[model samples]
Target chain A: MDWQAIRLSLWLATLTTVSLLVLGLPLAYWLATSRRRWKFLVEAVVAMPLVLPPTVLGFYLLMAMGPRSPFGRAWESLFGRTLPFSFEGLLLASVLYSLPFMIQPLAAAFAAVDRGLVEASWCLGESRLRTFLRVIAPLSWAGILTGVVLSFAHTLGEFGVVLMVGGNLPGRTRTVSIAIYDQVQAMDYAPAARTAALLLGVSFLVLTFTYALRRRQRKPWTLI
Target chain B: MDAHLTPSPQLLADAERRYRGGPTVEARFDIPEPGFSVTVLFGPSGSGKTTALRLLAGLERADRGSIRFGGATWSDAARGLHCPPQARNLGFLPQAYSLFPHLSVSANLGYGLASLSARERRARVDELLALLDLRDLEARHPGELSGGQQQRVALGRALARKPALLLLDEPLSALDRPSQVRLRKELRSLLRTLDIPTVLVTHDRAEALQLGDRLVVMDQGRVCQCGDIQQVFDRPTDPAVATILGVETVVRGRIESIVGGMATLSVGSARIFAADPGGLGWEVFICIRGEDVAVERGSTPGSGSTARNRLPARITALNPEGSLVRLSLDCGFPLESLVTRQACADLGLSEGDGVCAVLKAAAVHLIPHD
Candidate 1:
């Protein structure tokens, strides 16, 4: 098995999950509460990843992060490096691929909170930020946890976007999925099976834990 | 405006709002004296009672008007001045689900005490728990407690802030009848001890009567009457106010004569005397509540009774409403009387039975025909 590819995949997944969480919290909250006229437009854009093919999304991202694009030129100027086929490129691709996984659950959770509870918090002299932290955060922990775990797992299994953007750069961007694909094409069935088994086991464990936690939180009496 | 005339140090409000698909509310009210008193905003559903409370609490903005709470301008649309709910420093207990479901009862009580020291916060929480009889449930979350317990916790949390004003919007409407009655009494006593101005909005007449020190009758987004509880209950400003107060009988009468302080009025061949004789030869409405109309057996009016207005009537219908019996009488004009079930049984009262409906002249309220 290619341990380097496994390490790269884990790092990319962790970084993508963290960045998605940071970006998704406010976006989800705004979607849940804002009454702006164009809110649905933003919501649709966020959910585009769920419906569009991963390769299609990665194709646009690849062009956007290339040297000819303004963003790509700015990135090279500021960071002193190109974005295409680098670790940062793969990380950005993974974040976009897993954006919906991080936002949908969070938006639903926030929207499900009793509005009366929010108003009551405000009436008790709590600011909106404090109410979100002290009341909304605790109530929506389950959705947040679901979003985090789903994002991590989805990013780990990414293939089409990583290949479209990273271009099989060996140790730099060759994640576990690309390694398995390369091994399979080279007629190396043993290594491919081992790597595939590892991914399956990790995904199973994460999904099992999330499902169990959700079940316990939903029907607390079942825990007893 | 006189330079020496200072604004009164009371809670005054004049608010107007027009919703796109809902009612247009134009409410104007002033509490010239606001201290340690419960002012009930009573009306039917869709009457804008809750809207008025929300405007006072800054939960909803008014289109045009100003609110001055004890000399501080909370909201003034003309000047574009408004205070958010957080800065208003007021407690609001909604109809239900006011307690934070995730917080323990004690933590819920301690939430608004961010300015207090840790020790003081704990002491304050403990004091509220004891005062609200919630000491045993301090560790329980809102979901773990009963509805009545949750309501008590919500009340305790609201009072924990020692807010400048307390706004309660049907706080007891979600409880069962027995729990509602029990909690209302407890709330009345608890509110009496606190020296805060309270505005409670309720659609229940019984709750309003039992809890209100001052009453404001609202109808169609307007305050129809505002006065002391008994005075408003006794003499509503108009027919709409009387109907909202659950005044059972409202019969039109023509003033016949005014001898001394008593005024004799004729109602469809029946004579009734009222305590007020403002103007003779004018039509007026004689309003009386079901509970104030006493019933006695036989057609002969109580011989030695002091009640000046006694009419012989025939019982048309009898309704058993829990502990009390409602008797529909036809004393020339329609009238209703509410009596205890025991009194109903002792008199052997039934439909088509003849009885004397004794209404004291003082109980007879007169509202001039509009």
Candidate 2:
């Protein structure tokens, strides 16, 4: 029943979801439309985290966030501290770990969009940026919704990455999954059950709501 | 390159593209790949006709070709220059009638006019609505409209910008017969008035023949022939061109006689004369327009008058050609002539009707098939 850990976990997951979307959308769009030879390479790298253990990604991220590494040193110089064991650190780790979940569905959805529609918009003299905002984004809402919800839920359940990078610091880095472990280790079964139930209920409700909204927006031709 | 060699305004206005290499498909035209006042890429489907249209639109990059449009190098693969579709300033009505379903008719029309003033945009949209006969449906959403209506809206949207070049990729393919005819007529008049170089891709030969000022016959990703409609129709470059142009029927017979610019050739018991002569005793493919053959109820052949190429034939089949009827007749040879339903009704025509098929010998063109 540690409130700070629960609050921190929620914050980390939310921040990760938001940042992932911001970064993933453009990347997905590029990957979806690109004919470059390196596009496959880029896709393969994005998909690496899906197959690789979360701890492996977390280990690299941990090293990358430490003050000894170049990126970590630059960050330290900017912020006056190491990023590990911080909420921002957890967000970055979760974003990377959950990237494919957010991007794949979105990219698939965006790709599924009738290319004729895109070409039509271009022929209408709408800029690519405007077309994406007005046509691609609105039409691909279902896939995007699925991607966002999946990323958020996956980030919420994220364990190995947060444990390795965020370092289970109560009131700062300790998320609900880590908090549940701590409760059970201390033989506090009741609070662990409560937290586990909370995670399950919240994730289920969010996913259900997102799916319902998608169904509502579904066109008759989209039934298949 | 000399400074004088750089294209002038008139040169740009009459841009021509001659692409070679790559998967050899025959399109040999000197046309600006972009910014044409009316450059129609006309041929049957799978004829590389669509590719030619796309090249002009700057949608598909050519493998090895130079495209100059309105004094700009749209694409020159050998020179490693390719202008993207955005820079082409083209109005393309792609197949599937890619109307913005989210936007209403007016909004869809106004989308391309963003570069213009508000008043200009409004005026343009209004003019298009009137021109397309869509003034009454401005408020309707694309999804709510019929396929024909959506097509018109798409055409309106494309025309709203008044692009330097217009590319129509089988825009009328999805419409009903009536709608197709209506739009075809409207499109011809509209294109003429706008004077924007247009490239129309279609599989419908009649549509191409009617709409294209100069038809470019393409096959297997190449242009087989390119010329004015009559030139191409009268004398196709090859048998393939003849086939694509739907002029494949040719009668091989020695010239028995020639009279008044028409040569009579004896094929089997029936005599077929040239509507337009090739040469005396020269083997020829007698090209006859399907509409030129008229059916009669009686076996008595019509006396040769101004209308020539008369034959005593049996009605083999009747095929519908929109409002008209096309009769496939056994004129002692496998040949078909297209005529209207009103004509058939007036003649009381039917299957197995023994009739003398009246045709003008002048309509029977002689082209070298081999």
Candidate 3:
């Protein structure tokens, strides 16, 4: 069943989800609350992954992180490694590829918070940051959960971005999706079927848990 | 409502803010004098009533003007200075009592005491819990409480910081009719005990009359009149103010003569007397509240009813307004009288019936109009 590939996928998805959490939350908050006139442009850029083909995104990501590129050279000088084919590179690619999955739900949740609560907090001498942490963050638990689940699930199932950014390498960048493809190509149909079944079961369980959580909400959060 | 403390509006403001695709709301609050009492920002919907309160709270920025609260200059457009609500140190109850959904009653009350020590905060929260009469529901969340309970919790939370002034926007509008009326009395007495200068926003005239010591009448995004509550409600300055004040009957009248401080005005085919507004223009708008007009039989001109201007008229319409019945009459011109259903039954009044509309000479207010 390519258990090594499965483990690697899990690790990549975990790191990618964490990285997106650190990066996406503030960005999502800003996107949700900012009143800037040109904020739509930033929103569009963040949402690009939703519409752009994975292969197209991967192509640009590879170019931006190539050995000859400025970012690639800077990374080599600091981390002493190229960014195109390592685990770190795959993690970064996954984070970018699943950006919208994390951000859209988070932004929607933040925006959906009752504005009256925010104003009340301010009136009570609480700063904006305190209000966000105390009032907004707690109410937005559902969105955060949805973003985490979607990002992790999407990164785990990614095939095209992984193929373009992280070339197949055993114990390094060969994620479960790549392993499944490799098994099918090598005529290892039984193992491919076993791996595919495991993925289907996991996906089904994750979706069921998510829907149950949403349905049980006393106050319904956004469907997304 | 009380002389509990030396409270002052201590606030002065002349601000203007232009809304997108709407008229500019110009709030001119000049309560430069001292002593605490309730001041209501009274107006109809879209009349900038809430904006006026928000201007004082530092929530709504003025496009051109300044606000001085206490001794500090809160906002000045020319100087490019504006204070945030957090620094304003004011308790603000928004139209909706938005108690934090996730927090319990105690936590909601303690939200503003972040700077206080843990023990002090707890004490303050407890004080509020008792003051607002929510000790039993301290552990409950806002959703677990009823409408009135949630309102008290919200009020407790706002007062946790002991703000200098309280600004409430339609504090009772969110509740059901019964709770709203009940809370209306409770809130008034509560504010009286607290003794802080308050600026409340409400479109309901009954609320204004019941809660406010002073009233600021607003219309079309401007202050039409500001004075004592009873005075403003009884004698609005102009037709616009009179209409916004809900002065039920306003008819065009010409001053025919003035004698002994009483002015005789002629309407379509009837004559009436009002306290002279001497030289307040010959063209006048006569404003009379329905409650001030009493209904009697047409034959009872000198019956014990002492309202001076008892004009003989025919009933036009009868509409029920809560416990009272409003009788529309064609007494020379249109007029309205609010009487009990029992009074209607006693008089056996109905549409097309002749009746005497009794109005006091002082009840008729004259506003000069072009």
lDDT per residue as tens, model 1, B250-360 = 666888887888988898778989997353237666778899899999977557888898899999999998899989999988888999999999999999999999989
lDDT of 3 by residue, B103-160 (tens): 7899899989989999999999999988998999988878899888888888888889
Please report the candidate that would top DockQ against the real structure.
1
Ranking by DockQ: 1, 3, 2
Q: Which regions of candidate 1 fall more than 4 Å away from where they truly are? A: A218-224, B1-9, B248-370
- lDDT of candidate 1 over A80-180, digit per residue (tens): 99998999999998998999999999999999988988998898888888888877777888899899999999999999999999989888999999999
Measured by TM-score, the strongest candidate is 1
CA error at residue B255 for candidate 3, angstroms: 33
Model 2 ranges with Cα > 4 A deviation:
A218-224, B1-28, B31-38, B117-120, B248-370
| Runs with alpha carbons beyond 4 Å of true place in candidate 3 | A219-224, B1-9, B33-35, B248-370
lDDT of model 3 at residue B310?
81
TM-score of each: 0.81, 0.76, 0.79
Model 1 CA lDDT for position B8: 83
DockQ list for all candidates: 0.54, 0.40, 0.51
Evaluate model 2: give its lDDT.
Answer: 0.75
